[model samples]
Target: MAALAAPTWRMGTTSLFPRLFSSTQQTRFALPFFPGVTLTIPIGIQLGLPSIPSILEGIWEGILKAVPKKKTSHMKKRHRQMAGKALKDVTSLCKCPACGETKRMHHLCPHCVSSEQLLHSLQRRKAHPADIFSLAPTPNSILSASGSSSLLVHSTTESTFPLIQTIPNAHKLGCHHVCTAKGGLGNVAASVGFGGEIKIWNKSQNKNEWALDWEIPPSGDVWAVALSENEEYLACTTSDGRIQVWDLNAKQVIQTYETGARGGGSFAMSVDLSRDGKFTASGHESGAVYVFNNDAGRMVYSLSGLAKPVRAVAFSPGCKRLAAAGNAGIIALYDMQHGEHVGNLTTPNARPAWITSLDWSDTGDYILSGSLDGKVKVWDVTRGACVATHSETEGALWSVRWLPKNERALGPGMGKGEMFCAAGASRSLTFYREATGI
Candidate 1:
């Protein structure tokens, strides 16, 4: 800077003088000229000004103008207050310690709500652990066979969860399933054991609990059982693929249907008797569902719709529909009258897991399903759409049933009807009711 060169100027992020033409000698030769234009003229000097960026910017803006803007959401805002109250926190609702979310109070937990509401409506509303083995609902109490060879009776309506009575050595090893009359009016009940022995129990008017009414001779390992609505007929399925029907009064295997075509697995997961006791259905591990006519004493339909091992099967209250679901994660609804596939209820992908339990609402207006993913979904059969879904737990849900809505006793707004009960590996029972604004 001996001579102190003229100070350079700078514009925003660019240089007033380009680096390539920083020297006066370079700038002189860098200027461009139009034909017949003299460099000394004003027009020629003005044209030499930098204008490449301006032209590029104009082209860029024009391209941007051709693109469209995104639209805003038009959905209405939801009211937080009512939605909050409708779901009562059920974290503390159940008596068992293992019951987690089910125990929270006031905020209805989805798993418990769906399970309790549906199962509570069944004629013989009952729940038990897989290890418990047997369940029988009496008018005023429920009898269960514990994993032990003993049986426990619980009062159905007591304020506290009280054990009414116990029977020791009720089973040689352990009973697997049990059945009672539809109404539970009489004290009669039936149970099937691992030893293939079927035992009937009855409570004397004077006795506090049930005593062994009779035990059928060994057939095979008893896997499943069902009782007629009238409690006059008892049906039991064995590992050998034989369905043994017993006359409760005559106390013998009146008829036996050889259901051998279906794959024979040791576990016949489910057995159901139609409301009218006209039909009996058995779901096997081989993914085969069989519906038998109790009146005809023969297999009426060997249903072919489902191929996955059928875990649960139920008949509608009117005996017009039969539903079966299992590991396939599909709920198949069949018309009992026409023996045609009526429709299918699909589970959402978020909860797209195995379906473990299913039951029809008392009116048959809705079908409730419990899945291994711990969700209870209420499906509107009339519309073939899911009406509501409750996330009950993160654990597998073993059972769900619609409760008998006691409409007559319900106060205002409790319109939908009775509640249901759900139970599973969680070792607790959850109750749920249709949302009533009141």
Candidate 2:
């Protein structure tokens, strides 16, 4: 064909390929050799009797997608879904019958267990017919003072705390304060009465009864009193704001401390003698706390801070610091060495109530306080924090004292070796023991 050039071949474009196909799935092509001649072939025959390559590829892809993935364990699937949860709901709870408190089912009630501290009522007895004002614990007995004229002694060595004896008509006008000295091998107790008289008592060698040994006439009006460890000296606070130290053996005043001319001689409400007999401290109604040196026979330091009628003052067992409190509702601590106010212990967000009594633990680590609001608090001196509190009555608590550690009672289930007793307008003496042994 015109010396027909070698057969020409060309690739089909998408637009040209569509024209090559017919409605019947057949393809038509014009031959160059014959001017009007056309060639027709079945699409299946022209395309090798099979589906289009692109369609086959799509079908293969769909089949691959329909097949299942590699099998996975139920645990692995669950882990992927729930990965970040910790707490589980408690399905059961109930009310405790003993304490009327809500508690977890199958578990003991926390309130009842903690209320063991109040089990003190286990040995409760009417210590005094009237309100008990003070409690002083000896090695084996507790001496209680009340509005009555007699002093009641209870035997703590017995489980029932039976009344062992009573000092009849101990004070004609009724005693307001009673204290015992760590007074070497003998028992020496001192009592101050509203009649302005101070009496010294001695335990009888044959009867185990307290007998009046001697009496010291009031120089002025004796309001509060304390005895030295050896019972060799006595410290008393006067109505005119003077602290007088008396020689017990000599039966005379040996030293006197004055609080200056403030408020026309502030009323000395409380007085305490150091265990070493080297210092005497006093709290005054004019909000002044004074420390006096016995050897020098003069006032050494005047501590100021609680300006609201200081009522109670106490010295640490070491005689290194002083704690003073009163209607101010806070306890002020002072360094005896410098007479500087060191710190304060205050109840958080509580209305100020008069603190009536303060006592330090034998170890000097804790300070026990009783307040007019009938609350007793145990303060940790080193941490400056209240470690325990008890409010069994709404009436004022006048006195609180820590009992000497009892080695025999420190057995299993007996709580801490430490014990304390509180008394006041509630007309009862409540004993408390540490819930856990230290």
Candidate 3:
């Protein structure tokens, strides 16, 4: 510079440490920082390099970027949260006792737990146009009958509980009661109509469809019906208070049982066949429960606990116990061997809704019941107490059937979660599952 202007400096450099410019061999520049301030910064002017302010600004901007101030991304936050949760789960992993597989310590292993109870309704479908009267659960499907003349088959394993088949006008007037074998593996089904026609159905192996195998010669006395596990016998209740077991192969009534008298007994309202095919049970209008020795062709025991119309009756899978319920709103259990009154299942403040349907679980540990109040209940047989209850609508529930347990049908790595279906005035088939299942 020809004439050195006075080194007028108002403020010091922006650098917090002023000693950074102390080196005598480096060049010091008074950079403009504010209107009246100057920033003194050192620059190495070596090898024909110049101490330029723009280069210092570039370095300062680089430093600013090094002190990151960006917001955390959602993916990172999720990764951190999941990482926290995964740490907790690592502590619970243990070898399962039954299968030696990795399993949560507190949860039951699906391989060994067989008593998983069916709890809440998981799937519901409006199955029929009129009131649904009965439900018969096969291993993978459900058979439903309604006031409409159609017979509907719904698959349990499918999404949305789809209706797989519909037998149009299966009954001339309308069907009231339909039943499948007590054991889930049978291919036979029996349905009773309001017109007193009993139709036998057999599943076609090629198409997995049902066709009318035979129709019992018209008899107006038929009411509720049941099928034996072997699929060889069909048991039905009669309005005339008689229970008859038909030999399907012979197409004739092989055994006929009377309750009160030879011609007249209580109106047989409900009936069931023991899975063992050794006993037939019936509930009647006179509040009586009768058990017959199918092998002996004689009545074994005439039980008397329910003082109202006995509407529903079911036998355990092992045929060790029997359950009977009806207008009295109480479920009475009986010892099948000696026909002793074993116990009763009753709610503390149960409604006056008459129980209309009953079925036993596969392991004979629990029993399911449906009532006129549109409530379903599960009872623990050993505890003699109600374990769970569910209600969907206030319409009368006419039938409830437990879907049989089939390993192939359940698929691999699946629990033996008990399942059952209920149907009634809502004209819908409601499927339920164990609480643990998805």
Task: Give the top-scoring candidate (TM-score).
Answer: 2
The lDDT values for all models are 0.65, 0.79, 0.77
Per-residue CA lDDT of model 1 for 255-374, tens digit only, reads 777777554543567778886778888888788888888778888887877777887788888899899988888888888887888878885565468887777776788888888877
**What TM-score number comes out for model 1?**
0.63
Cα displacement (Å) at residue 273, model 2: 0.3
Residue-wise C-alpha lDDT for candidate 3, range 1-438, written one tens digit per residue: 211222333123323435444433433444454343333444543455546786799999999889968799999999988885673434545665456777654344545444322221233446688999888888778888888889998877743456689899899789999888876575889988888989999899899999998888777579988888888888888888888988888988889887766767879988989877789999888888889999999998989788899988988888888899999999999998788998888988746678888888888888889999999888887887876677878899998888765454343334466677788999777766542232
Candidate 1: where is the Cα deviation over 4 Å?
1-136, 158-161, 184-186, 261-267, 388-393, 403-416, 434-438
Cα TM-score per model = 0.63, 0.71, 0.70
State which candidate, 1 or 3, has the greater lDDT: 3
Model 3 ranges off by over 4 Å: 1-124, 406-416, 435-438
Candidate 3 residue pairs in backbone clash? none
lDDT of 2 by residue, 1-438 (tens): 422322221123223455544335545577797665445544542334456786899999999999999998999988887877646776556666555667654333457553443344444546677778877778777888888999988776644456789889998777889988642334888898888999999888788888999998866688998888887889998888888889988988898777766335888999999988999999988888889999998888988888898889999988888999999999999999899999999977558789999999888899999999998889999999887777778989999988776657532233336677889998777766542213
- Score residue 308 of candidate 2 by CA lDDT: 90
